[model samples]
Target: MPTIHLRRRLVELDAQILEQKRVLLDLQQTRIAVERELRETATYPILTLPVEVTIEIFHRLPLEVGDKMGIRRNTAPISLTAVCRIWRGIALSTPTLWSTMNISFDDIPSTVIAKPGLVESFINQWLGRSGECPLSLTFSLPQLEINSLYDQVDFSIRRLRPIIRQYAHRVRYIELDFKEDTRISELELHSSPFPLLQVANVCCDFHIETRVFSNAPLLHSLHLGGEEGVIVTRFHLPWQQLTTFEGFIDNLDLFIVAPNLIDVKCYWSGRESTLGVITHSRITSFTIIRDCDILQYLTFPSLQHLDVYPLVTYDFFESFLKRSCPPLISLGADAAGQGFAQWHKALVHVAATLENIKISYVPHEVMTSLLSLEERPWLSPPWRTLNLLPNLKTLHLSPVYGPVDQFYELVRFLYARSDKLRSFQLEWFTTPFLDAWIGAGAPGAHEKADTITGHFSRLQTAGMDIYVGTPNRNYAAKTHDAADV
Candidate 1:
């Protein structure tokens, strides 16, 4: 009986083992099927399209991306040949794609031009590829190492001069950057003339003595920058089409005149005459860097915006407002905690038509004086009484030192009077007055701060925009002794 029972158990175990083997076989077959399907899908050949269709696809790509594909470099054509025979043919045939070229001779490889014939071949290939289409060229020449690269510069320029002069009428923009003084002077003398050049951006250390602008009849924009005391004097150059001009000059009296000038920006050499020339121009927008007493005498008839640093005195402030009051929309003044009486008087004058005001590095005493002047009738309605411009909408007060109560009082005064007030920006340096002011009040009180917060909150909520370090919260002392004084 025991033997028969053992035999039954052994047969059952054998049957279970056979069943396991069958299951493993089925899994292996399933995996093989999946693998075959994957290989078939992955190895499938991509459909071959017509050459015209492919070319159309390439043209549709962004110019920037095409440029990154190595089209801008002189070796790009040769590199594209390695991509594929079909790609090489397409790249070679696309003359318009190769028209825009950027040449840099600063780091030319020794292997590239070890032989004279190779160098000439490389230059001819790049210039000849453009073929009848107007080419855009960007030349970046380092002035410091021109002595070492002088031969390369001459060779490249000589090779490119024919192409540039031929396509000068079609060229739209030219950017020339020279770092070496000697090379810059040489380039200024021999620079190619562009008849249709509309934009010229030049940055060189040497003084620009060439008559390069004579050929640019349609030149509308000019940006020039270099060392101090660089005088630019040109006569008979077309300024009727010129709209924007920016440069650093010791004097503005050098130029004959820019009749169509709309925007004028200058970094003055602290000279009185330069300021005089800028003030006399009919520019709609004007910006001066430094403070000068002569600013009071100059007038911009069509001027709408003015920005200056190191605020001028109260007398000059009032004089300028009264003189150039019409068409003025925005004004920014930096006092740097120097003159309060002048700033107060200027603030009054600015309260008239100014829409935006930024006062940086103000003193605690000034804040106290401005805030405590509620008793004085003239200061009661600050903006309303003193040249209160009805059109004034935005006010930015920064770097104030005072209590929350003082700030609240100031806000109330401005909110009551400025019906068109849409924004009120505050940059707090040491106080939590902004947070408390926004947290303290009724819907109407919050509404005033909200108007400013809603419009300019995206720029900065705390003192992040302020140049003076991080802000901290401290409200233990109700009255600041230094501020009170």
Candidate 2:
């Protein structure tokens, strides 16, 4: 029995030895893992790349993203540490990456100046990183906040004075979104600091004081939006390189001269002021939206396209065509409810070089005016007539209260007279008229239907197209009676 007990004890000893061997293997594996991690952490590359490559990669990122990544103009140091230790060190060492600052104060509450010092520190870090490179600052202030700040908004404005003065020569673009009165008063005062600014887009409710633009020699494009009472007293825009100008002025009388202006869009919502003084012959395109009657005296000698939505008398049309006598290539006008006599009076002096014409609201009385021109003996031959546009390729008519026959007659006249007629589009047809036209012929009566089909087919053969469709009926009744069906 004693010999049997000794054998059992030896088996237990073997199990203990195996357990210790397993623990030693685990310790050796853990030591190797720790050593490898230590080596990798020590060898990580931080800012080892050339500065040029870093700058190029930085430029590929958007300004907003860069700003969020800790790159800011003059004041805020970019925080690259959040990404990885290596990246953080590289971003901190590079100053040029942090030169451009985009200050968006739209959501910042004006009442809370609690973090002004922190905000100022961030701005300074970005400037310090930027070094001497020109700073691009974009300030977007929402209308609600601007209104809330009112006279008190200038306190926040004063915070930017130091940065503005330091980078006055380095600032390239200054976009101020006033949208309210708080920033309006400061615009004039801040103009003198941005000497290197080239482009400005101001959306304010106040007229820019004339003295504000007196020193802007490099300003090329200006977009001004304000109330109708804001008058532009500054006549001489100093930007010799200016090409595009757009704004809604209170009065056309304030604008007398623009020497190098090429494109001008003016929206006059008030009473039409005299535009005789605007004689910019270099203007190629002009859009006027107003309820004025003084269009005749204004001249656009080099104008190619003219779009006017006048709520005044149709006489403005005849007067402008007589005075300017431009070879207009495209013309769009709405003379709805007016007789054909008025249309003829307005278009009689129009140039024959017109290639496209769109006239809406052709009343029944104007039917005779179109037919009377066909009977004139002194008028040139149908195709060669001065009043009929030979180069006209497309004609669109939107009749208000006229018969289908009037449209048919006009189409026939244009097809017979104009050699370059290409397409005719008829829109907003009444449902009753469309039903009658579509239901004219009896079932299986193809010959009688041919009359309607022939009109469309002929248009196709002559390289002309016609469309007959009704406007969308969104609010109409869905259920229909047997009679309607």
Clashes (N, CA, C under 3 Å) per candidate: 4, 22
| Candidate 2 lowest-lDDT run of ten | 476-485
RMSD of 1: 10.2
Most accurate candidate by lDDT: 2
Tens-digit lDDT string for candidate 1 (1-485): 79999999999999999999999999999999998777555643221567687666555554432222123344445555566666678878877656556554445544453455555555457657667776565665544343564444233443445555555766776666555353343433235566667776666653545555566767888766565644665323455667777767665553336667777666666555633424444667766655544456566667677766665555665666566654667776665625434465555544545666555656666555654553255544442233355665665667665443464555444434334555654445543433442322222544433322221232223211312112443222122111100
RMSD per candidate (Å) reads 10.2, 9.9
Count steric clashes of candidate 2.
22
lDDT against true structure, model 1: 0.54
TM-score of 2: 0.58
My TM-score estimates for the predictions, one after another, are 0.60, 0.58
Name model 2 segments beyond 4 Å from true.
Answer: 1-106, 109-114, 117-138, 145-155, 160-174, 183-198, 205-210, 213-215, 234-241, 253-255, 269-278, 294-297, 334-341, 358-387, 394-426, 429-485
By summed lDDT, the worst window of 10 consecutive residues in model 1 runs over: 476-485
Q: How far off is residue 129 in model 2, in Å?
A: 8.9
Q: What would you estimate as the lDDT of candidate 2? A: 0.55
